[model samples]
Target chain A: MAGNTTPTDFGNPVINWIDKRLPVFTMMQKEYGVFPTPRNFNYLWNFGAIAMVMLMVMIASGLVLAMHYTADTKLSFNVVERIMRDVDYGWLVRYIHMNGASMFFIAVYVHIFRGLYYGSYKQPRELLWILGVLILLLMMATAFMGYVLPWGQMSFWGATVITNLFSAIPLIGDTIVTWLWGGFSVDNPTLTRFFALHFLLPFVILGVVFLHIAALHVSGSNNPLGIEPKSDKDTVPFSPYYTVKDLFGVCVFLIIYAAFVFYAPNYMGHPDNYTPANPMVTPPHIVPEWYFLPFYAILRSFTIDIVIPFTDIIIISSKLGGVLLMFGSIAMMFILPWLDTSPVRSARFRPLYQKFFWLHLAVCITLGFMGAKPPEGIYTVISQICTFLYFAHYLIVLPLLNKYEKPLPLPPSIHEAILAQKK
Target chain B: MGNPHSHGAQCSHDAPQKHGQEECPDNGHDESKRDFIFISAASMAAVGTGVVAWPFVATLGPAKDTLALSTTEIDLSPIQEGQAVTVMWRGKPVFIRRRTAQDIELARKVDGDATAFNSLRDKQKDTDRVKQSTFGGKEMPQWLVMVGVCTHLGCVPMGQKPTDMRGDFDGWFCPCHGSHYDSAGRIRKGPAPHNLAVPTYTFLSENRIRIG
Candidate 1:
């Protein structure tokens, strides 16, 4: 089996010597060089490689920013300013790291949507999907902690408000918040620890990314057609074929990222964050980074108290409900492989599922918009509705659709699909 | 043997397997176009990697210059009694107030009417708010020094200016979120979870203060 061993070349003395010991080169050759990939992958498939490249860009830029950044709350803002003005190309690095975070999310969201559309989480690939969700959670933590390192008004208050959410936990809530702060408030100790964790988390993400790819390679890749390669005719060597394709996709992604970094660097960032952290003044509107807007919107949606039916008891406060709902939205994604009960993997073949998939995308984007806006009259009403649909599409819609919807007949193989297209 | 490697026509059906190589169905698709795409792709990847690498190398320079500017000293003589002045110390606002006799009396008066919010947040009393008789320094009950930023979300309070409305307690009122501080810089009311933080400062010969 392709999964068992790499084809080793004993002809070269160095490769022959290494194969006997570690087999590193042989494994690379087998896994990446000539690995069999489905032939008919589309542009959406390119996002996985694009996400990987963006990760590289972020880490490279972040390492430099960390070297120059003073994690002390008193000096963090000043130190970052110095990096922009005094250090050579410090501005460029800071901008890229800042914008790269947005770009990373852009690619990741597309990558996730591609998975959802093609049913990449089905059957043998369930573990691969779980690994991807783990990466998303880690990425979120890394980004949140990284945002606090600047120690601007937004950074300081953002950390305080977000960490304060834990205080909603019943018995040990305040203690947990205190432990997280390492002091009475989000002060020097909090900054120091967040910096340490922020620096350390990317490497942990790198480890999980490795496991994600390993799980992917174990089951081979899902294709646009959402079918297995029945014969050699249905597949191509990964090298020179997908490598060139991925490289092209990565370059295109980089061009967009560079445009943001060089031109509109602060476009995605909040203007109030430029001011140094002052505990006395709060920005009139406190919204998180754009990447977190959707979740933020969901969190804000639960404005009214949930009264238990048949009783006048206000069992769950609106505050606690919002927290649970926000977390539950992300948690639903972790169990998606189970939640989506469709026999046919890809939405392309499933007519009823395909329409709801687009609805899901629209609901998410709407929630993000609502999150960015203050929960006023119309936005509040819309957010509650969108949050409902967002959960329903996954939980209620997908499971029910599995039994009722009739799928279109699939092509025999990837080779035949391409052949039919040519004629 | 010169043409030993020569295979059939370049199509999936014509040559499904040639030696150990598997032929993809789309092999006959434009070769020159693919070459052009690959070249552009390779160049862009190189540029992206190069752009991100420049910052990692430039930050190797020393960042020690900013570290030395952490501690600051302010002249208390210039700040008159019945007035508080905000000073920039280590990138944060430090509120220095030379308290009047009236102000001290108002803060010390027993308040059975309202809650002392600062006591719950900071666990310190009005007497403990000052550097009073601690570290053998001269007890200056008339002088009050605290970080000017509010305990809520880090906005400087409004009571520093005489024209500014000091919330009902006749002290600093945080206009940002309605956190009102007493004459002694203790939290009195509003959403602020604590009092204005008191930074570590000692009187330098009773006319100057050195703060870190």
Candidate 2:
């Protein structure tokens, strides 16, 4: 019930009669039609819309893929191959979904980074940001369980390795792990459960995304200038302006995504995944999908067990340590608003923070690069350093910068900022 | 006030909380009864919800069919000396290595290496890793029986085949990670938190073994 929106009579009597009872059209007009949005958002802002499009793309493709897929370990891999080779345009649907994951992640990462750069996590938007993080986590879980549906080598092994992480707990760890597997190993039970969950969690992500949008609406959209809209001049209606811009952005994004799907379908996929899962045979190297590389690197970085000094008391075994660090990397986002302590929302005003932001991005890329390599020799060393830096960016760098770095004066309003930029 | 239809909306709206309130005395009996009913309803609803949720949670655990394939019997006669053969048991691989004299010696030689034993991720003695099998009515610790999966991430190690590299320790090496095992299946190096697991097994005769 926005103050700006009112019941409007369309030319038809049926529409007017229905609107009086349901008010759905009224909601659409309020939320999407006449909603006030910041006027001067960059191309990066388009990613949120792009992510929404990809989500729908993934869901549609995945629904079709699920119909053809067999989750039984014996037939799953062959089922996937059959879908690709035999079914009408099944290859197209499968490829769209396969690349849709990477596309979705690409859009989401940019959306997240845009949020971070603009301090979208600050103030009244803490819950909004938290909701976004929750969606990310759900997406990660959905993506992970989805990866296991094919019952290919990577699917089986990836499921095995990731699920085994829970076994590092002190007591009942093995029991919990057994419960996770639904047996002694990642067999039919695990695959079936993963399939069910893979189907379930996307809907969960979609629900959280609804909450994310609801929260964003409550706070109003954060812009590049990081200033509140002081007047009508600073904002535009959501209808034609953003709807058209977002459509164009989606078009541009689809071209790149489509190229990968058609020309280089297997570019992001591991070659070993083509082979059916063999409980008796193991692939030489087991790497997770690229979106998870940074965290995977963090998972592998803790090689030495932490011992309490002078007591010969071994606490926090290396396995547990690695698991903690890997999870902690993501948990950092949940508490990021409190950690930064900066008044300025946008990095444009904080030169020092902006520099560190690039460094943080570099550290993440380094972690991703090192994650692809085996956890041995120089790779582990690099991973360790990058992992440490990745955490430090939130824990140390941002907080310290908040205290020391001098921020330039924030413009009085979004409108003024745009006017000044034009000058 | 005369028309009952006029008050129908209010009556229905307040019915649950104010049921029979107008006729009741100002005593606490009705309130207490309401409380009792509320608590009972809540408790029953909770129990009902929990009862409904039990099967959904149960479905996620191991099904009966998966749990049924608990034991595997192998004909040991076909397994050659110095060769490791993998057999399916409980949806996992069980490795049975027919040890040659040198393989036994190589394993036993390291038994006395205290420094080497200390390096094991999950320490187990060579004698502990193998069991006696009959040959001409004489018992020998010849067959090394263990679960074939690597303890790190459960990838089956690569030394089962004749051509596969068994790592520096002359034992199975995990192809997924680099966990090395000795001839006795003791984890010597890499990310594996434990030695290759020795499953419960017994020799039925000279040529048959039952593994679970």
Please give, as one word, the docking class of candidate 1. Answer: incorrect
lDDT of 1 at A166: 77
Candidate 1: list runs displaced more than 4 Å: A1-7, A308-313, B1-212
Q: In candidate 2, which residue pairs get closer than 3 Å at backbone N, Cα or C atoms, i.e. clash? A: none
Task: Summarize candidate 2's per-residue lDDT along A235-345 as a digit string, tens digits.
Answer: 999999999999999999999999999999999999989999987677888999999999999988887767687543558866788899999998999999999878799
**Candidate 2, CAPRI quality class derived from DockQ:** acceptable
Off by over 4 Å in 2: A2-5, A308-314, B1-48, B100-106, B132-139
Over A165-238, each residue of candidate 1 has an lDDT whose tens digit, in order, gives 77656569766766677654577767888898899999999999999999999999999889899999999999
For model 2, residues B1-212, the per-residue Cα lDDT tens digits are: 12245444334432535655553232255456667889999999999999999998787778788788888889988877877788889878888888898888888877889976665556677887777546568766788888888776667888888899898789888866567788888877776777788888877887888987
Compare the candidates by TM-score and give the number of the best one. 2
Clashes (backbone N, CA, C under 3 Å), per candidate, total 9, 0
TM-score of chain B of each: 0.63, 0.75
